[model samples]
Target: MECPNKEKNLNRCNCSYPSCSRKGLCCECLHYHLRNRQLPACCFPDDVEKTYDRSFEKFAELVMKGKI
Candidate 1:
């Protein structure tokens, strides 16, 4: 089934990974990341998102630093 909010979600998506099929699909993106033991790009700020360090550790660090 097509996601009705894909376009709207894309407007807010911060993923920097190119050629991502899940770019605008939050559910798929989240599931993919979780399966890899990582968080999706949208979980971090633009700067951090670009670093591609979507690990739970990274997210926790950012949270502790109040950067998220």
Candidate 2:
């Protein structure tokens, strides 16, 4: 199968994290996040993505603190 990233036209995603396994496939991306008890990259703003806290609990904390 063709890679989903083939259509992204991106040299790099703005996810900011260097170690994300969900770098391209949107379906796999969401699945990975759900399996890991975390939110996907789309939930975060630019600044928050820089922090690299992808956990659901951490995202909730950000909401509670009005950071995201």
Candidate 3:
């Protein structure tokens, strides 16, 4: 089934990974990243997201640094 809010979701999506199949699919994106021991790009700031370091450790470090 198609996501009802795909277009809207895309507007707020900060993922910079080109050709990502889960671009506008929030649930799938979250699941895929979590399964790989990482967080989705949208969880981080745009600059940070661009680094493609979505690991849980990175997110924690950002949080600790009050940058999230």
Candidate 4:
């Protein structure tokens, strides 16, 4: 399904995955990441996001460190 907010969402999406098809599709990206036991890159800061470590563990660690 075509995302109606694709353009708008892309403006705020921080996903740095070079060829991500869901870059501008928040719903699809969220579902795909959750299914894989991960969070979308948008959940992370750019520095952390670039590492591509979107796991729940990573998020928890960041939260504990007050980095999120």
Residue lDDT tens for model 4, 1-68: 79999999999999998899998999999999999999999899999999999999999999999998
Candidate order by TM-score, decreasing, is 4, 3, 1, 2
> lDDT tens string, model 1, 1-68?
98999999999999998999998999999999999999998888999999888999999998999998
**Clash list (residue pairs), candidate 2:** none
In candidate 3 the C-alpha lDDT for residue 33 amounts to: 99
Cα-based lDDT for every prediction: 0.93, 0.72, 0.97, 0.95
| Candidate 1: RMSD to truth | 0.8
Backbone clashes, each candidate = 0, 0, 0, 0
Per-model root-mean-square deviation over C-alphas: 0.8, 3.0, 0.6, 0.6
lDDT of 2 at 12: 41
Please report, as a residue range, the 10-residue window in candidate 3 with the lowest summed lDDT.
Answer: 41-50
Q: Which ten residues in a row have the lowest lDDT in candidate 2?
A: 6-15
Q: Give the alpha carbon lDDT tens digit for every residue of 1-68 in model 2.
A: 65667458234456666876556666777787789887777778767777867788888988899987
Q: Residue 50 CA error for candidate 3 (Å)?
A: 0.7
Poorest lDDT segment (10 consecutive residues) of candidate 4: 16-25
Error of 1 at 40 (Å): 0.9
The TM-score measured for candidate 2 stands at 0.64
